[model samples]
Target: MLWLLMTTGKCNLVCDYCGGSFPRDVVSWSVKYDISKLKSTIETRDRSPTVIFYGGEPLMNPKFIMKTMDSLNATRWGVQTNGTAVRMLPESYWKRMNVALLSIDGREQITDKHRGKGIYKRVVENASYLKSLGVETIARMAVTMDSDIYEEVKHLVELGVFDKIHWQLNVIWSERWDFENWAEKSYLPGLEKLMDIFMQNLSQGILIKIIPFLGVISAHFTGGYRGSPCGAGYSSITVTPEGRVLSCPIAVREKWAELGTVNEFRLLEDPLPDYCKTCDVKKYCGGRCLYASNEKYWGEEGFQLVDSVTKKYLRMVISKLPEIEKLIDEGVISKSSLIYDPVQDSTEVIP
Candidate 1:
C-alpha cells in the first residue's frame, strides 16, 4: 500500500494552474492529529508501506516530514515538492528519501510563464542538488496550454539531473483554458513529436523515462490491470493535514473523495466508475484519472475532449510497440527497460 501523507496545505508559490495554496478549510495548513495515530493506522493496514510526503507544497512543514519519517517504519519515503524548500530539510534526512519529485514545467519561458519568474532555475538547481545526494529525482511537469510537450521534455532530458520525467495534464479542476483548441493545435502534435524522440532514444539504446509512454507500454506487455494509474482509491490513499483520508490527493473538498479518517482508514472497494470498466482502453490508461472521471469538472463535452486526447495518446504509443519490441529483440534496448515500478508515485501514467 502507498500512503500519501499531507505534511501541510501551505504552498509558497501560487502557480497559474493550481491557484496556489489549498484553502485552510479544505486542507489545514498544519497537521493536527498525533503522529502516533498515523503510525498505528498505517502499521495496522500494511506492514512495509511506501509513504510519500504530499502537500500544497510538502516542504512547508519539513518538521512534520522529519517527524513522520522518524515515527513510521515505511519501506520507502518520497516527497512531491515545488523545489523551493529543498534546503529546509537537511542533507541527512534527504539522503534517506527514496525519491523526490520536483515541479518544473519544461523550459524556462514556459515554466516561468505558469509558475512565476526564477522558479525554473531554482527547481533545476534543486533537482541537481538532490541528484548529487543520490536521491532519485524526478522532474514532474504539469502540462498546461502554453507547454510544448516535446521541447520541454527533451530539454529536461538533456539536463541529465533527473532520473525520471513525468507529467500530468492540467485538464481537471480549472476550466479557464480552451482545452479543445490547445489539444488539437499544440498538445497532440507535440505529443507525436515527443513519441518520435522517445523512439529515437530507444533505438540508440537509451531508455528515456518518458513516463506516459513507458507506463502504457509496460501495461501492454505485463498485462497489469489497474483501476487508476496513480492508484488513487485502489492501491494508494491520501492522509490530509486535518487527518481526512482522500482517495485522490487533488480531490480535497469533494465529498466523493472522502474515504475515512486517520483514526480508521478504509479503502474504497470499487473506486472506478462503470463506464471505465466498459471502456476498451481501461486496462492501458487505467481510467485516466479518478477525480476527473468522477467529478467531470469539465462537463461531459470537456471530459470527452480529454478522453479523446488520452485515446489518441494511447494509440500513438501502442502503434510503436512493434518497433519497440523489434529494438528489444535486436538488443538496441533492453526489454526490462519498459518496466515502470513507480505506479503509486503519482506519475499519472495516462497524461
Candidate 2:
C-alpha cells in the first residue's frame, strides 16, 4: 500500500483550482506533526512500503522531508510538488528520488492563467534542472474547460524535459459545472486529436503517456480491475499532519468520513457500490474517485460524469489496441510498454 504523508498545509502558488492550499480539500485544515513520531511510524513497517510525500508544499519543510527520508526503509519514494522549490532539496535527495510529479498545466498561458504569473517559467526551469539531474520528473496537468488538450500536449512534448505526463480534468466542484456535457463537447474531440498524435509518436518511438488512455489500456491488457478511478483508500491512504488518517487527501477535509487516526489506520472496507454491480463498465473504471462520487460534490450526475470520461478513453484504447499490438509485434514498441506499474505510479515505454 502507498502511504501519503501530508507534511503541511502551505503552498506558494494560488492556482485557480487549488485556491492556494496544499491538497486543496473541500474544508481546509493544517497541522504539523511531530517529526520523530512520523519517522518512527514509517520505520515500524515490517516490509518496505512506498511512501509519497504530499503537502501544501512538501519542500516548505525541508528538514522534515530529509529526516523522514533518512529514517524510513521505503522501497520507492515519490513526491507531488509544484516544482518551484526543487532547488532547496539536496543533491542526494534528487538522486534518491524515484518519481516526482510536478504540476504544470500544458503551456505557459494556460498554466499561468490558473497558477500565478511567471509560475510556468519557474516550473519549466525546475523540470529542466530535474532532467539534468536524471530525476524522473513527470509533468502533471489539471485540464480545465478552456484547455486545448492537443495544443497543451504538443507543448509538453516539445518541452522535452518531462519523462512522461499525467493529467486530470478539473474537478466539477461548482454546482454550475456541467462536466458530462463538457466531456462530450470539449474533452473527447481534443482527445481524438491527441490520440492521433499519440499513435504517431509511438510509431516514431516517442511515447507521450496520457493517464486515462494508458490506465485503461493497461487494465485491458493486464485484465485487472483499476481498483478505483483514484485508488483512494485501497491502494493508498493519506495521513494528516495532525495524525488523522483518511482515505484521500481531499477526504481529510471531510468531517463525517474520518476512517481512523495514524496509529489506528484501517483500509477502506466497503466493497464496490450496488450501482457498480449493474454497470457494464466497472471493469474499466473500477469506480471513480470516492470523494467525487457524491451528488453534492459532482452533482447527482457525478457517477455518470466519471463514466463518460472513462468510456471515452476505453473506446479510444479499444480502437487503437490492434495497432499498438502490431507495433509490439514489429518490435517498434515493447509489450511491456502497455503495462502500468502501480508501485512506481508510472506507465513504462521502451522506445
Candidate 3:
C-alpha cells in the first residue's frame, strides 16, 4: 500500500492542472496540524507501508520532510516535486529517498509556458544529480495540448537522462486544456507516433508506463477482467497538506472520502464504483473522479463531464490497442505492455 505523507502544501511553481490550491482562494502555504492526537491515531499493522512525499511540492519544507522521514520506517519513499526546489536541496536529501518522480511534461518552450522559465532546465539538472547518487529517478510526463511529446521524448532518449518515463495522456482536469485543435486529435500529431516510439524504445531498454493505457492493453489482449486497477483506495491513498486522506488524488475531496488522517485513513465500506469494477473504459478512465461523481460537487454536470472524458479517451485507447499490441507481440514493444508498475516505479534516468 502507498500513503501520501504530505509534509507541506508549499510549492515552488504553478501549472494549469492539479494544484491543491486551485479551488481555494488561499494561495500562500499554511502549516496547519491537529496533532494533539496524532500518535494515538496512528494504526499499527504487520507490514510497513510505502510513503510518498507529495506536496504543493514536497521540497518546500525540507525540515518538515526530514522530520517526517525520521518518524517513519517506510518500505519505499517517493517524492513528487517541481525539480527547482529540489535542486537547491542538499545531496544528502537525494540519497534519502528510494525514487523521485520528476515531472517533465515538455521542453523549454511548452514547459516554461506552464511551469516557468528555465524550470525544465532545472529538472534536467536535478535529475542528473539524483542519478549520480544512485537514486532511482523517473520522469512523469503530463501531456498537454501544446506539449510536443515527440521532440521532448527524443530529447530524453538523446540525453540518456531518465531510467523510466511515464506518460499521462492529457485530460481536462477542471478547465479544458486550451489549444487550437486539441479535441480534434490533429492538434498533437505525435500522440500516436510518440506512443509508438515510447513502446519501441521501452522494448529496447529501461521501463516506461503510459498509465491507464497499459491497463487497457492488459485487459483486452491479456484477458484482464473486471476493471482497470486504478489502484486508488486499494493500493494508493492521497493525503492533503492539512492531512485529509482521500481515495484517489483527483477525488481529493469527494464523497465518502477522506478515509481519516494519514495514519487512520482506511478504506470505506463502499465497493469501488462499478465504473472501476466493471466498465471496459475503467482501464482508461478509472471511473473519472469520485468527487466528480458526487452530486454536491459536480451535480449531474460533473457526472456528464466524467462520461464525456471517459468515452472520448476510451475510444482512443480501444482504437490504438491493436497497434500497441502488434508492436508488443512483434517485439517492437516491451514493458508497460508486459509489466506494469501501478506507480511503484516510473520511467526515468537512474544510472
Candidate 4:
C-alpha cells in the first residue's frame, strides 16, 4: 500500500541535525490542512493506502489531529511517535486507533543524552504501558555516533519492554561528520564495533530489523521489498508538508513537484527509469541514501564514508550464516527479530 505522511511540521526539540525541525512551525495545521497539498493527495487515493502519522511530534496539536485523521480513509493507519505524548492520549483514543508503530530509543543514559534525559525513561514506561494496553509496540531506535548500541539495546529488551524493537543506524551526514578531518561526536570507529557485535549476535542466531543499513541483504532475503535500482521515483514517492511531491524524501526542496494532497488522494503514476534498473547496486542497494548523497559538505567523501559503512554491514551478515543457522536451530531467533543485545536476558531458545 502507498504511504502518506500525514503530519504537520512541528517538533519539541531543535535538533540542529534533523530535517523536520527546519523553517520553524511551518505547517500550522491548527489553521488548516495544507489544503493545496492535502487536497491533491486526498483526491488521488492509492487504492486505499495507509496514512502514516509523521510529525514534529503528532500530539503537539491534538485538536487538529483528529480532524486530519478523519479526512483520511486509509485502509490502515500507522503512527511514529515518541512515547511520552501517548500518555496524554486517553484510553478511548488507544482502543479506537489501529496503532502501527511506536518510535522510542535505547536506554535512559544514551537516549536522554541525545533526545534529552528522562525522555528515555518516559519512553520506556510509555512503550511498556502501550503493550500492557494491548497495542503492539515496536521500539524504534536511531543509532547515533554516541550510542553504546549493544549496551543500550540489551537493556531495553532485558527490561521486558516493547513488543518488538526496530533499529536504524543514524546516517551521519558525510559533510557534517565526514571520515576525514571531522571531530564533532563522530562514531566511525563505534560503527565498526557495532558491525562486529552484529556478527557476534547474528552468529548466536538472533535477528534485528535494521532499516536502510541492512537494505540489500534484507531485500535479497525477503525476495524483495520494493524494486531493484529502487530510488524514490521508482519504488516509492514522498510528499512534503506544503504538498510538494518529489521522487523521494531526499530530493531538493525546491525541486519538489506540487502533487495532490492526501485529501485529493493521487499516487505517483510513474516509476523509476532505466538508470535505476541499470545501476549495478540496483538489485542489492537501490541506491544509497538520497539526503546523504546530495550533500555538498563532503564533496568526494560520499563514497568513502557511506560505502565503508555499508560494506562492513553486508559482509558481517553474509559471513554469519552458519552461526545464524545454529541459533535458529537452537530456537534463539524467531523471524529475524533480535539484535546485538548483550544486555537482553538472552534469546529464549528454549521454553
Highest-TM-score candidate: 1
Q: In model 4, where do residues sit more than 4 Å from their true spots?
A: 24-31, 34-44, 96-105, 172-175, 178-217, 225-241, 246-281, 321-351
Question: Which stretch of 10 consecutive residues in model 3 shows the poorest summed lDDT?
Answer: 342-351
Task: Write down the TM-score of every candidate.
Answer: 0.96, 0.88, 0.75, 0.70
Candidate 2 Cα errors over 4 Å, as ranges: 22-46, 178-181, 255-257, 346-351
Local accuracy by lDDT, each model: 0.87, 0.72, 0.59, 0.50
State candidate 3's TM-score: 0.75
Pairs in clash, predicted candidate 3: 162-348, 162-349, 163-348, 163-349, 164-347, 164-348, 165-347
Q: After superposition on all CA atoms, what RMSD does each candidate show versus the true structure?
A: 1.4, 3.5, 5.1, 6.9
Model 2 lDDT tens row, 68-105: 78877788887889998987789898888888889999
Each candidate's number of clashing pairs is: 0, 1, 7, 29
Best by lDDT: 1
What does candidate 4 score in Cα RMSD to the true structure? 6.9
For model 1, the superposed segments whose C-alpha errors exceed 4 Å read none
Task: Write candidate 1's Cα lDDT for 219-269 as tens digits.
Answer: 877875567878887788999999999989988988988888999867878
The 10 consecutive residues of candidate 2 with the worst lDDT sum are 342-351
